[model samples]
Target: MQSHARGHLVYAASGILAVHTERGTSIVPANRVAWTPAGFTHYHRAHGDTDIRIVFLAPSLARLIPDHPAVFLASDLAREVLLALTGPRNYDDTAPHYSRSARSRLLRVLVDELREAHEQPLHLPEPRDDRLQAIARMLYETPGDNTSLAELGKTIGASTRTLSRLFRDELGMNFYQWRTQLRVYHALVLLADGHDTTQTAYACGWANPSGFIAAFTNIIGTTPGRYRTSRQTTTSGRSAKSKV
Candidate 1:
């Protein structure tokens, strides 16, 4: 039921705000961080100031945190320690930079501090009832429908304000944020099925494909064209996982 966890978080400080999950939503703020447990449906974002840096730890490290949701402080020491990790480190034993002893020392410090930090849950402000679920599913499955809040509210017997609040509370996201996430997810599915962004955006109801592409890049860290190329490379590397 949470959005993130069982995945590592790296504190990359910069000023920008964006987070999207292939499934979950993201809430990015400098004061606090939200981490959800793995297979738990979550997302994260970087804010819009400048010089932003965040590193996602692998699932192996993420599993160490229990209870899924956590909020931690970006204290000076914590920040400094995390920042230290950004420097290049070597993994190969044969490389000149290899130093198992040093690597172990740094990792121990980083993990101990990170694990001991306080936890915060990424929360939705509204509650989700059957009505909201129905509407949400409809929007998700058919992004091109262009259903307005008024229309959806009429169908659900609630005021537009009520529905909007519900989205914020239960989903921990605003209407726009939630809709964008849904669009991004569908976009991914289309790309997976071999449709390009130009085709996917229109099919998904984006007024202009570029607009959708902009959203995709902001949330996903790359433009659709690059995303496809990079995805293909990554997929090829992991194709074996699909066979079994």
Candidate 2:
């Protein structure tokens, strides 16, 4: 959805989700949830068939989460509370007063659970400076490009030394680290779209499958094959339920 005054939480109960904003992208797989603060323009796309849930937090409750966008590993209690709040035939305004009170209590519990939950490494930080943004745009458009920072710097009219400093100062990551993270993010989308491990590796600029697998596992907390398999299984189950 487009950015607005209200901050919102996006969750996927049975598949994968990717959230894109000015800050960067965050992946929300099963048992994970994403929060986007108010006024930041962001959009979401599901990787597979998903039971998607959206919750808009009032200003007070939104203050409990980060001002920027983030992803957190959802606690079991948090997931249950979230599902109840966003479930089928949700609580209506015309319902009894006690029902409203219960809804308020549920909202509070969801916020509390999220507050206690640890943030995951799912967010890929985006750079704000013009020089860095130019480089980022190039890399994002062609993830498989293996151009060195020095070479890219020449095209962008900056010295490697200058660009290196900018990366550290602005994005808190060195050139290689940031590029690798970007590649990993692209790999996630490609794999989720049904590309096999070898193809994904090549598409994301890794010459060797083993290297790609290692990097994917390091950032994503799971092997690409396993990640794709789980999403496929979830999508299949949803399809079956729809047909029944």
Candidate 3:
């Protein structure tokens, strides 16, 4: 776990990134960007061959974003701005220098785009209660576990009613909701690993690809097939450009 001196935005241009802070884990896929406020202890885990891009925000600009960690939808303009700000100019000495004022303007545009964009539901809040934590651990370990909450409660020595209350009070979501989010998170990692949609769906605990597609679409705003294709295309494009 580490903290940054300034708030920053992290984007995964090709694969996936999970930004884990004390509060929760925010998933950053190709279509999303994650923001972490300054001094927030966090760690990142990259899934697949991720091309992670980070842009730190000045305090004045950071104030425009959420104080806590969040995941926002990356609009086309936002994505371009992020890429330009962290693009080749930073490394290729022969490339024209990216002027500070130009960078500042890009940052402003990025922030403005984010402010206009919707915050994604890619954040999985951490469970604080011991029982909730145990449940979280179980689901995290095996997202495909189709265990019922009542059955899970038995092993944890908590009644279903108590567990339900804990889920509501501590996690702010019901067991099913939390579990779905966990499953989706795992599905994303699996997809980024190049798994087929059918395989990913079943692996992530969905009984069928249709159900998985519905849930994935509901949360991610895209079908698993489309997401996979996009990732593959992006990776291929990057590879082709590298060969140039």
TM-score of each: 0.54, 0.85, 0.93
Candidate 2 lDDT (Cα, whole model)? 0.80
Query: Model 3 lDDT vs. the true structure?
Result: 0.86
**What stretches of model 3 exceed 4 Å from their correct place?**
89-96, 237-244
Candidate 3 per-residue lDDT over residues 1-244, each given as its tens digit: 8998999999877788899999999988886899999999999998887777788899999999899899998889998877676656233222234788987888899999999988899999998889889989999999999999999999999999999999898878899999999999999999988899999989989999999999999999999999998888776534111100
CA lDDT scores, all candidates in order: 0.55, 0.80, 0.86
Write one digit per residue (lDDT tens) for candidate 2, span 1-244: 5897988888776677889998888878766889999999989887756667777888999998899898987888987776667653232222223386787788789899899987877887888889899999999899999999999999999999999999999878899988888888888778767789999999999999999999989877889999888777655543211100
Worst 10 residues of 1 by lDDT: 235-244
Those runs of model 2 whose alpha carbons end farther than 4 Å from true positions after fitting are: 88-98, 237-244
State candidate 1's TM-score. 0.54
Q: What is the per-residue lDDT of model 1 for residues 1-244, given as tens digits with 9 covering 90 to 100?
A: 2344335453424322234443334343333334445555544443222233344455555656654444454556665544445432221112233275664555456556667775533322222477777787788668777778888889878898988888877777777776776677667656766688789999887999889988887765568888667545433322110000
Cα displacement (Å) at residue 112, model 2: 2.3
**Candidate 3 clashing pairs, residues 3+ apart or interchain:** none
